[model samples]
Target: MQQVRAVVAREKDAPVTVETITVPDPGPGEALVRVQACGVCHTDLHYRQGGINDDFPFLLGHEAAGVVEAVGDGVEGLAPGDFVVLNWRAVCGQCRACLRGQPWYCFATHNAAQPMTLADGTPLSPALGIGAFAEKTLVHAGQCTKVDPDASPAAVGLLGCGVMAGIGAALNTGRVGRGMNVAVIGCGGVGSAAVAGSRLAGASRVIAVDVDDRKLEWAKGLGATHTVNGAQTDAVEAIRELTGGFGADVVIEAVGRPETYRQAFYARDLAGTVVLVGVPTPDMSFPDIPLLDVFGRGGSLKSSWYGDCLPSRDFPLLVDLYRQGRLDLDAFVSERIALDDVEAAFDRMHRGDVLRSVVIL
Candidate 1:
């Protein structure tokens, strides 16, 4: 066991504190990682607010990249000194999903068998099972996906969560293809990534919709051909106008709210796809729509979980693209901060002041 400085949320809606916590050495099938950089994501704030669960004294931060320091018994395909992106979906090979060769939807995932705790021996529930706001963390060996050592950790680490989710919502769940007209609602980190992903997938027109003009500009930088200020204009009508009076072939909902979802549902071409990648609170429910309209849609309505990505396959490919300059992962990084600045970063995120505030360990 070793003590490290980490950001901890001790109670609901309380300010997070940098506390000394104990991280146990890797047990069987686990690995120890020296986290190089971690992104301060909204999900971490959700955990702090008790929005995820009543798991108190949570170890926050998940989206991370690092180097392996040690590996436990029975671990293979990974070793000390490997540069890796930590993923939450560490597939359990024997699960039914994996048995069918669809590990991306693996129902059973892996995490460290042993627990990291506070100095007083209280267990800390790791955010997204990663808990990477510390200098070092322990995770299932399978969670460490090796990527290009030359890639920027701050940029590529985001693939562990939001970035990947946005890109995957288009590339995987939406099945965006060449010449497809795509529209991404909510120009946050995830929505901007969807815009980028649409461009990467060869979409002809990628429309970005958001209430914040600043975020809309960010989406343009990431490759949105058109921008729609939902607050200023009717999003559905704007999208239809931009797409030749039809609509987008795929509309990605990244805001995770009823209103944005409704816009996505309506702002798609007949037989177009709607991919919901946003994370909504448990209390929220889907909006009421006519069964007749649902039947008339004649297309897929899908929800993207972590962009339905398989980290082992996608991470390395994306890091290579970043290295090749074909994909601009760096643009997603708004600023670099230390572990102590997480609470302030959260405030900035809430105010739409930044895209991502990465913690440089």
Candidate 2:
């Protein structure tokens, strides 16, 4: 057993605190990772707010990169000292999705066989099955995807979640192609990445829509060709005007709100794709668009789960691109912080003061 200091949310709406927790040695098919960096994501806030569940004393933090420290029996293709990004989807090969060769949609994912607990033996529910806020964490061997060792851990760690989701939404779900027009609604981390992905896929114009001017500027740095302050203008109208009055070929909704979804719906050209990458509260429902409009659109309405990514295939590729300077992974990192600074970072995130505040260990 190993005792490590980690941030834990003990109750709903309570400020998170650093606690000493016990992590056990890796069991079969698992590996122990010494986390180098982890990014603060909205999902962690959701868990802390009791929006995810009533699971209290949650061990929070998931978007992470680390070095493998140990592996248990049956682990293969990974070793100590390997640089890796932790992924939530550790596909079970026997699942239906894997059988159909679509492991990205794996119905059964893997986590550490054992649990990390508080001093009183209360098991901590790891956010997204990867409680990486600590100095070290245990995870399924399959959850650690090897990436370029030379890449910056503070930057590449983001690929473990939001950044990957945005990029994947454009490349995989939206199928952005050369000369196409794309618009990303919401210029946060995921939305900015969507803009970058669209540009990388050769989109002629990438429009970013957001209420916050700062976030829009961040999107611009990530490759947005145009910007729309949705708070001041009709986003759908602006998107249409930017795309020669035909609307965008691909519209990514990253805010996960009904109003923004409606904008995305009306902001796409005929037969265009709409990819929803945001995480909405359970009480939120689909927008009240008429069924006739849905049918008349003549295009796909897709929900991008983790950007429809296969970590084993996408992580290394993205890391390489970052190394080549083709992808600006570093742009997403607005600040670097210590683990003890996470609470303040959350306030900054809530106020839209930063794109990402990465915790460096």
Candidate 3:
């Protein structure tokens, strides 16, 4: 075992503290990674708020890129010195989803069998099974998806979560196609990435909606052809106006609220898709839309789970696209900070002041 410094959250609504924790060597089917960069995502904030679970002293950080330090016995096709993005879902081949050839929806994923412990020997729970806000982390071998080393760690790390979800929501789940009209609600990192993804998928008109004008401007920079300030106007009507008064061909709801979802439901053209990529809290309840409206809306109402992405397939392809200049992953990273600044990053996130604040180790 090796001792390493990591940010740990001890209780709900409490601040995270930097402390030393023991990082054990990888066991069977696991690998130790030297973390290069990790992004501060909303999910991490949720975990700190005890929204995820009651696992105290939680080691919080996912959406990371790193170099493989060592491979445990029984691990194959990986070695030390490999550059990889850490993924939360390590598909278990025996799971029902995997057996059905949909490994992307693998019901049972794997994490490192051994635990990293606190100095007093208390076991620490890893956030998303990847406690990467540290110099080193251990994870299931399958969690490490190899990518080009030339790709910037901060940029590629975003692919491990929100960015990938947004892109895949458009390209994979929504099946956006050439000349399609796409409108994405919410102009945060995920929503902007969806707009970019729609453009990359050949969507002719990419409309972005947000309450903040600054975010709308940011969305346009990411390839949105039109921007709607939802705070100033009716989003559904604006989207309809932009798409010949019919509505967009596909509407992506990235805000994850009933209000935004209702707007998305009503803002799409007939027989159009509604992709719900935003996450909703447990307290939020569904709206009482008439069953007739559901029946009349002649298209799919889908929820995108991590954008239905298969990390092994999508991560490398996205990194390659980034390298080819077809995708601008770097544009998503607004700023970079050290590990100690994660709390401040969260503050910025709460204020909607930045797209993504990455932590460079």
| Candidate 1 Cα lDDT to native | 0.95
- Which ten-residue region of model 2 has the weakest summed lDDT? 278-287
Q: How do the residues 1-361 of candidate 3 rate in per-residue lDDT, one tens digit apiece?
A: 8999899999999999889999999999999999999998999999999998898889999989999999899999999999999998899999899999999899999999999999999999999999999999999999999999999999999998999999999999999999999999998989999998999999999999999998999899989999999989999999999999999999999999999999999999999999999999989987677789989989989999888999999999999999999999999899999988999899999899999999999
- lDDT of every model, 2 decimals: 0.95, 0.95, 0.94
Which run of 10 residues does model 1 get worst, by summed lDDT?
A: 281-290
How well does model 2 score by local distance difference test? 0.95
Residue 91 of model 2: what lDDT? Answer: 90
**Against the true structure, what is each candidate's TM-score?**
0.99, 0.99, 0.99
The alpha-carbon deviation from the true structure for residue 100 of candidate 2, after best TM-score superposition, in angstroms, is 0.8
User: How many clashes (backbone N, Cα, C below 3 Å) per candidate?
Assistant: 0, 0, 0
- Off by more than 4 A, model 2: none
Tens-digit lDDT track of model 2 for 264-293: 999999999999998888989999999999
Off by over 4 Å in 1: none
Q: Quote the lDDT for 183 in model 2.
A: 94
